[model samples]
Target: MASDLVELDRRAVLTTMATAELVTLDDLSRPTPCAGWTVGDLLAHMAAQHRGFAASARGDGADLAHWHVRPPCPHTPAEYAESADDVLTAFAVPDVLERTFALPEFGPEVTVRGEQAVGFHLVDYVVHGWDLARALGVDYALDPDAADPVLRIAEMVPDGPDRDAPNSPFARALPVDDGSAPLDRILRLLGRSPTWPDRPDR
Candidate 1:
């Protein structure tokens, strides 16, 4: 089951990365459903996140104090695509799931078992990938099997200090219509406005 989940997550990352690669700078500058971040900022942020995750997969410590956003290189979109590939490679490495990793945000110096860490990466990338696609006017879909576990994990994230910190990426709780699907409800609960800008015509 863990392997299957990882495979689904890999597929989601690849699909989202391809969609992101197709976006033009003009499209990236447009307003996104995420309150303050433009599409470009979101792209940059995701690319950095991929790189950071890749580093972590290699047993690099979680002190990203030296991490800095590299300026978009010769072919910026391609670079982002490559970063996604790097993340996939790191995650797919043999025995990677047998290692311990440091996740600072979850704690100052705590260690998580391999499967739990993989699940965390899967949830983060898959959801953030959806955010990028929704913001960039691209079609994005998560494999149902993959999304199911991620939604469960998301639900367990209590709406407390971790989620309500001043600089938290998620917003405070919002009312989710009872009829909303799990994915939409989860997104809304985490501060994404379901009615922002305009719904995608697709």
Candidate 2:
């Protein structure tokens, strides 16, 4: 499961990078599914997350400085790509899955096993990759095998008031039909709409 999670995470991050590369300067101003954040803002957040996860993989995640989001700039895509590389490299270390990951963003004393942390990262990129693709009016896909595990993790995320907290990355969960597609179900569980900018009231 650990190895599978790593491969899926790698694919998700790489897919996100490919989608980001398709963005021209003018596309940066485009609105994203993430409320109030533009494409550029999404890229900045993604890059910061990459750096933070890399630091956590290296047992250096407790420092809040590593997770600070960079301001959007013309070279945001390239910066995001670099951060992606850093994270992939960090996760490549021997016995990394056996180490503890300090995720200070969760709380000052929060820590989790490496495999769990990787699973968390995997779910994040899977969703955020879709966010970027939707923002760019493109498509994003993860490995077919990823749907089950990702969905399980998404289900485990609390659907309560914490979602509305300041700077929370997710919003309140939305209801989905029992027959909804796997990806759509996962998205709704994480407070995202698969249809995105095309809501009926919009």
Candidate 3:
């Protein structure tokens, strides 16, 4: 089951990377419903995140300060996409999951089981992929196998200090009715107000 989830996440990451690559630079500068970040900022964030994940997979501890963006270049979109693909490939390497990961923000260099670390990467990218799509007027969907685990993880991210920190990008928790579907609830739980603001009023 764990192996299957990892594969599903790997596939989702690849698909999301493709979608991100197709996004135009014009779209990157537009306002995303995500509030603070423009399209470019979001892409930059994802690129840095991919590099950070790659570093961890290579046994480099997640030193937040080590997170640096690739130097600005003319073909920024292509560069970001390539970086994302590189990280995905790194994560897919044999026995990567079995290795220890040092996430400094999470605390002193704790060894993360390979499977769990991949799961974390899966959830992060899938959600961010949706963010990219939402901001760019593109469609984004996650593999059910991948989305299921991410939804579970999203549920576990309490609407507390982690979600409400001073510089947190996530919004305050909104009241969701019991019957809301997992995906919708998950989006709302993570700060996206599920109602599509782009729709015109009849």
Candidate 4:
């Protein structure tokens, strides 16, 4: 089961990479769904996160330095691809699911089971993949197996003042109709508007 979950994470990551490949240097300044972050900023953060998760897989995640996001620089897309490959390789280690991941960005002593951590990683890519696609004015879709589990995980994310705090990674959850599609519900639960620019065609 853990391996299956990791496979899903792999698919999500690969999908995100595919979307990112469409980005060009000219697109770097474009704003994304992540509020103030432009495409370049988002890619830099994504690559840093990949490296951090890879370090976590290797029992070195306790170092906060591993999770730091740096300024956007030249050849960011290439760097992002390399970071994605690094993380995927690290995650393929034997017994990886049995390891503990230290996610200091959550808190100083924050730790999660490898399986749970991978789930976190999976959801991050799913949403960020959507973010990238939207910024590029393109469409994005997750693997069929991902919708249910990612939605389940999104539902489990607590909503409240914590989300309103400064530098909060997520925004406050928005309302969505009960009959909304899985991806719509998932986006709202994670504080993203499906019609991000208020377009009727979204």
Candidate 5:
């Protein structure tokens, strides 16, 4: 069970969607760890990301038309769950990992290796799962098996000035304390406060 990133990713995404299903309509309007996104916004973004990534697995990633978030529309929890499943299915296809991903969101020239693209998606769901649980005031406990593999993927994503460019996929890395918990380290590496809602009132 060493470094099974694909399975870890599948577990994270499925659990996150399950957690999201518990979100009441009122909770949809509540804030999440993402700066300007509410729970609803987060769900919408997740759905769009799932579809976009699935398209990428099919080698259509360079099609800008496939990358835009769908316009806001009424949606149910089931739809969100299905979207997560879609990408999982796409990634499961035979030889999918051997294909390159052209990520136009990063830049026209920014293509990602298959395993790296999967790593990127895996880490996103890990953090996003935490964000959804926090937004709903629920506990988010990653699977015990996920820590090592997730950490490996987290460290692979660089921090520092590269993250500060306008429209950069990630916010600048937040400072993390030594010997922090694995999840805490993951959040900070990706610029999210582990204690998001409890951030000192400004």
Candidate 6:
């Protein structure tokens, strides 16, 4: 039977964010593997995403104004964790998963059914969680159930040229050694370097 994919993904995202929240003010300036985003910037972006997705689940996604990636987060860990909670609550609303999501940022001309949109968000956080973990020199481990659904979702992402666009939802899938862990394969699929930063503390 299918569990709430959104809820499963949210739990994983929260587990990941608990690590990100430990980031000190000094860590805020540190570079993340997400190209140009700094630690604080990623947190703020993730915060906006949680707010935006929650809004979208309520049928507010057509409003691009809510999706803006703002300046570095002014929030503390507790505040960021609250954002996670907010999105989880939104996803849990009865019949939310039955709606369509108008994700203008991906393509103003396109729309996705609720479960597809949740899958998009799920794979994104899976990779973003890894990005945060690598930058923080910490190990990230998702519950197997969380990682399982996400890998199926990850494979749906296409490979090659279109992914090179600055606005591509993902980078071109990265090459992986055979038999990588599901989460590791998901990272590679989203174009993240699993061994990022190479810090001794990691």
lDDT of each: 0.70, 0.86, 0.69, 0.87, 0.80, 0.75
Ranking by TM-score: 2, 4, 5, 6, 3, 1
Best by lDDT: 4
Segments in model 6 whose C-alpha atoms lie over 4 Å from true places: 72-79, 167-169, 199-202
Q: What residue pairs are clashing in model 6?
A: none
* TM-score, candidate number 6: 0.88
Candidate 2: where are CA atoms >4 Å away? 72-75
Which ranges of candidate 5 are over 4 A from the true structure?
A: 1-3, 160-169
Residue 4 C-alpha lDDT in model 1: 73
Pairs of colliding residues, candidate 5: none
Q: Once model 2 is optimally superposed onto the true structure by TM-score, how far is the C-alpha of residue 201 displaced, in angstroms? A: 8.1
Candidate 2: tens digits of C-alpha lDDT, residues 1-202: 7778788888888888889889888988999888878888888888888999999998899998899886545547889899999999998887778889989988999999988998998998989999999999897776688999998899899899998886567878889776988898888988888888888311
Worst 10 residues of 1 by lDDT: 66-75
- The C-alpha TM-scores of every prediction are 0.84, 0.95, 0.84, 0.94, 0.89, 0.88
List, in order, the clash count of every candidate structure. 0, 0, 1, 0, 0, 0
Q: Write the per-residue lDDT of candidate 3 for residues 1-202, one digit (tens) a residue.
A: 5767567767867776777777776776776655666777767767776777778888785676545555555335776777777787877777887887766656666667777777777777777777877776778765766656777777766686676564354666666655876666667767776664655211
Give the higher-lDDT candidate: 2 or 4: 4
In candidate 3, which residue pairs get closer than 3 Å at backbone N, Cα or C atoms, i.e. clash? 97-114
Tens digits of per-residue lDDT for model 6, 1-202: 1356867777777876788777988888888887777777777777777777877888888787777765544645665677778888888877776788888877776678888878777877877777777788888886777777888888888788887776444666778765988877887788776777663211
Encode model 4's per-residue lDDT on 49-135: one tens digit a residue. 899999999999999888888654653788889999999999888777889999998898999999999988988899999989999
Which segments of model 4 are wrong by more than 4 Å?
A: 199-202
lDDT of 1: 0.70
Which of the two candidates, 5 or 6, achieves a greater lDDT against the reference? 5
Judge candidate 2 against the unseen true structure and give its global Cα lDDT, from 0 to 1: 0.86
